[model samples]
Each structure stands twice: as C-alpha cells, then as structure tokens.
Target: MNDMLQVARREIKTGFRNPWAYSFLILFCVFSLCLLVINSQSIVQGYSGVTGSMLSLILYLLPLMTLFLGSFSLTAEKEEGSWQLLSTYPIGSLSFIVGKYIGLSIVLLTIVAFGYGLMGVISGLVGMSFDSTTYVLFIAFSCGLVLLFLTLALLIGSLSKNRWQALTVSVSIWFFAVIGWQTILISVLNFLPYTWIKPTLVALTFINPAELVRLFVVIKLGGGSILGPEYYQWVDWIQRSSGSWLFIAVCMLWISFSIMVVYWLWERGRSHG
Candidate 1:
C-alpha cells in the first residue's frame, strides 16, 4: 500500500513537472468555463433546461479531456524507457498498474470537480441549485465513465509499441465510446429491419459511457426534452431500478478487462525482448 502510494505520488509529480500536462489543465478549465457560461445564458433565455444543457456541455468536454490525458500515460513512459525503471522496485506488476491508475484517476477527478464547481456556481447564480441526490448521482456516474475511459486508454497504451500508435488508437476508441456509438445506433435502427432495436440498443448501452452518463444526467436534470421519448423511457426505467449499480458493474468490467490486457502485454514485451 505504501509503495503504491509512493508510485502514485511520483506519477503526480511527473505530471506537474511536464509542461504539456499543465497546459492541458489550463485549456480544459478555460473551455469548460466558456461552455458553462454560454449554455447558462441560453438556458436563462428560455432556450434550454439547466440540467440537460449543462450535462450536454460536460458530455462534450469530459471525453476529450479523458482521451488526451490518459492516452499517453503508459505510452510516454514506455517511449522514454521509464516504464522499466519501476520494475526494479519490489512492487508487484499489479501494484504498479493500480498505482498508475490511482494517479491518473486523481488528476481526472480534479478536473471534473473543477468543471462541476464552475458549473454549479453559475447554475446557482441562475437560481438553479442542484438537488443533493441528483448532484451526487451525476458525479458518481460521471466518475464511473471517467474510470472506464482511463482503463481503456491504459490498456491501449500498454498494447501499442509507441506513443503515436497509442495516441491514435486511444483517440479512436474515445471517439467511438463518446459519440460513435450514438451515430451507429441511429444508423442501425434506420438501416436494419429490426422491430426490437430498443432492446438491442439498451444492451449496447452497457458499453457506451456517453450514453450511460447522459442517461443519468438527463434523468436527474430533467431532459431538455432533447432526447427522443424512447431514450427518456429507458432512462426512467434505469433510474427506477438503480443506475448506480449498473454503472459500477460496467466500470468493474472495464477495469478488469484492462488489467488483464495490460498484464498480458507487459509479459509479451518482456518475453519478446
């Protein structure tokens, strides 16, 4: 536990020391604040609902932030030959993996928290205080989405041989997870001759972080009535039963799969070398 924490601390320090890392944070903050301000203005003008509109802004930004920050974590280390340095320590491979995740998760969470805080302040100024329950739900589920993205990127980084490939693959996966699923769903329902596309789509929802986050957000914030009735109905059902459970289940699957893939790749690299 102590060693893992040390590793996490070192990772955090390295992030701070890197110029690109600091730049990402600054850019994210500026973009997020601008988005909140723009959307809140539209909401006040009776153009959109606070919850749905704010959530839409977050949905757009979160995936981009996740992809950029996480895609290079392991890949950069591998490129610089620093990844092997950790192996000299007594930490188990699993501990090293977990430590890396912990460090990245903290950084991502800080970004999310900052964005949420900025949004919340603006919403409050517009006389829109978040319901305690709904706020908690939104944060929890969104964090779950972040965890899913982080794990997937880590796996991609471990698998790819270089930073460029890792970045390309990671961004591609992020695109699919964030928006490609929605495009594909629309096309599938339109092109395919399936009467039960809803059920199939619901199944696909488990793998779609953007959809899951949006569902929880819409249900809590009251959909801008932006979603079709079908999506709203599904969100209502998930809300009634427990979206948190589903979020946890999906996140666990992503984390476990990532761990397995990273471990396998690490072994393969060692053996081939």
Candidate 2:
C-alpha cells in the first residue's frame, strides 16, 4: 500500500511536468473558451444543440489527451530505467501500475476540472445561459473517459517498446475510438445477419469505453431516441434511476476487467524478464 502511494505520488509530479500533458492543458483551456465564444449566442441548457456541440468538441479533445499523457508516463518509466531501478525493490507489478493509474487519474482530472471550471466561471461572468446540470454531466462524462481510457493507456504502454510506438498506437486508437466509431461499426455490422446486428451493436458499444460513456451521456441528456430503434429498450432502462447505477456498475466492470488483464500481462513479462 505504501509503495502504491509512493508511485502514485511520483506519478502526480511527473504527470504535471510532462510537456504533452501541458500541451493538452493549454489546448483544452483554449478550446473550452472557443466553445464558449462559438455558443455564446445560444442558451446552453440541458442537452440542446449548444450543449451537444460542446459535448462533441470535448469528446474529441479529452480522450486523446488522456491516452497520450498516460501512455507516455508509463513508457517513460521504461525508457528512464525507473522500472529497472524499482525491480531491485520488492514492489509488486500490480502496486506500481495501479499507483500510476491513481496518480495520473488525479493529474488528468485536475486538467479537466480546471478547463471546465475556468470556462464555467467565464461563462457565468459573461452571462452565458448554460445551466449547472450541463456542467455536472460534462464533468461526469469527462471523468469516466479518463478512468476507463487510462486502463487502455496502461495496456498500450505495457505493450509498447518505446515512446514512438506508444505514440503511433495511441493516436490510431484515438482515431478509431472517437472519429471512426460509427463508420467502422456500420461497416462490420453490415456483414452480419440482420437479426445479429442489434446484439452485436450492443455488445460492441460496451466494448468501447468512449462509445459506452458517450452513449450514456447522450441518453441521459434525452438524445436516446436518435440512437435508433435498436437501443430503444436499453436506452429506456438506462434513463431510469436504477439504470443509472447499473451503468456505473458496468463501467466499474470495464475498469476491473482491463486492470486484471494489464496485471496478468505485466506479470507474464516480469516472469520472462
């Protein structure tokens, strides 16, 4: 436990120093302000066009920022021989990795909070009409993305031999996860039997953390009908109070499953090394 905390503490310091982390911080703050300017003319209430637009813009920025920031942090441990130094100690791989996850989560969430908090304050001062519920939802959506995708980052960093490889794969994943989500799903699901498509789509949605969280937020914001007939039941259930807790449980399962896989992989590599 102490070792995990130590690693977490170290990670918090390193994450703040990472140039890539700062680069994203600057970009997010600027983008949030840009969002503020672009939607200034409209009332950004609930899940209106303005708030939807804001959500879309944030979706693009946050995931990639997290992936890069997190993957780089893990890879740095390898490149700098920090892992080698740690091997001399009795620390378990799980402790070290979980520590990194905890630490980096703080750093990334801090960035999210600051970006949105600044935007909220500025919006209020300027008399923008966005409500507080929208901010709460946005913050929840952003935090979920961070916690879930950081698991992928740990996996990517563990798989990668160096930073360049990590960078390449991370961007590729970001593109697929965020940009190409619908196209790829539609293309692949097209080949399946008509009856299979819905089930497959549902399964695939759960498989992708970005899509999962995005869908949850969309449904919460009263956009579930737009998801088409396939998700009618699922969306309806999720909109209910009990369904909200179920969604949270699924996210917990996602993180737990990913972390288990990461630990197994780390243990395998350690044994071989």
Top-TM-score structure, candidate number: 2
Q: Model 2 — which ten-residue stretch has the worst lDDT? A: 42-51
Report the CA-based lDDT of candidate 1 relative to the real structure. 0.69
Q: Can you list the residue pairs that collide in candidate 2?
A: none
Clashes of 2: 0
Which regions in candidate 2 have their CA more than 4 angstroms from the true location?
A: none
TM-score of 2: 0.97
Candidate 2 residue lDDT tens string, 1-273: 999999999999988887877888899899978988976887666667777777788889888988888888878878999888998899999998899889999999998888888898999898887766766888899999999999999989999889999999999999999999999998999899999998899899988999999888888888887889988988888888898799999999999899888889888888888
Put down candidate 1 lDDT per residue, 1-273, tens digits, no spaces: 988898788778776676766676677678656655655443332223555555565666667667666767788888888867866667766677778888888887876677667777777787753456556655765686687777777777778778789778877876677657778878777865566777777777766767766665556555535677667666566556576577567568768877778777766776576
Separately for all candidates shown, the number of backbone clashes (residues 3 or more apart, or on different chains) is 0, 0
Provide the lowest-lDDT 10-residue window in model 1.
39-48
